[model samples]
Target: MTEVELTMSQRLRCLVIGIPQATFPEGLLRPDEAASIPYAQLAEHLPLPDTLELVVAPLFCDDFDALEIIETLGSAGYRRVLRIVAPKLPNRQIVLRELRSHAVRQGITLEMVEEG
Candidate 1:
């Protein structure tokens, strides 16, 4: 999203999945609007997000973990896009296509982005 669009979307809640809490990239998120969760703790209950909810996760994780994250987010009442950030991933076209289809079926939008 463009900077102006993001600024317009108030309280853009985000869940940084599996990334260490310490590496949450300070200043990238407004304190009240974001949090990082360990993959192991994903089973815990999460509040239904208000407005847009952006989920940041690694694309290189085990396939099951990726699917599980989607399921968990859906179960937690997340109804917006899950924006996964990865620097690089193999078989990008195939992976993105498959995941996009699955994400759509679960009533979630999937957006994959590469970042270093």
Candidate 2:
């Protein structure tokens, strides 16, 4: 008898963060494109991707959790590109300012994707 080895294939990882109530843009992600996980579970889900996409809600500006998310992802070696999808909001400017600053310090390339 011969022994055979098996391995699991890895899929491209993309992180979408924001309030569940917020609407996600159509065609942002394919039905079978990527695995969806809550922001809270990001850390536990290891082997971070070189590219990451973040969909943030304006409401997140009220807290520091959003910053933490970016920092965490950067520290984990997600340095290729950090795509942010944010819609117009009362605090959109403020939130984006902070996120951009953090991303620069972390050496992560930032790409702001305007909401359609």
Candidate 3:
């Protein structure tokens, strides 16, 4: 994925991303609308804690790589991260467990999005 610096003035600098065939709804801050990303290319643009927030569309649902992303973010000193996922995904539990484990390994806590 191609990444650029976003200068939004917020405590949390979030990056919103959508997977292939997954639609990113309105209200997302897209730094580059014309860039396409490969699953493995995200390493280059991993968000730093100094930025405050990052949003990304995962290539695979509930995969280890996704957990790695969270771990990476956590290692960067990010205290919080919001992972937006499809409500209808089949592997939600797997992802959740993996995230939990990753959190445990990293000595940080993970929070899930609240449902209305």
Task: Give each model's whole-structure lDDT.
Answer: 0.67, 0.53, 0.49
lDDT of 3 by residue, 15-78 (tens): 5433545344466644333233444544555443355444554523543355665666567566
- By lDDT, the best candidate is 1
> Every model's Cα RMSD, please?
7.1, 7.3, 5.7
Candidate 1 stretches greater than 4 Å from native:
1-12, 21-28, 62-64
Tens-place lDDT per residue, model 2, 9-84, is 1333344554444444568754333444456555565555433344242224333354676687667776665666
Per-prediction TM-score to the true structure, in the order listed: 0.71, 0.57, 0.48
Rank candidates by lDDT, best first.
1, 2, 3
Indicate which candidate wins on TM-score: 1
Question: Candidate 2: global Cα-lDDT?
Answer: 0.53
The C-alpha local distance difference test score for the whole of candidate 1 amounts to 0.67
Give the better candidate number (1 or 3) by TM-score: 1
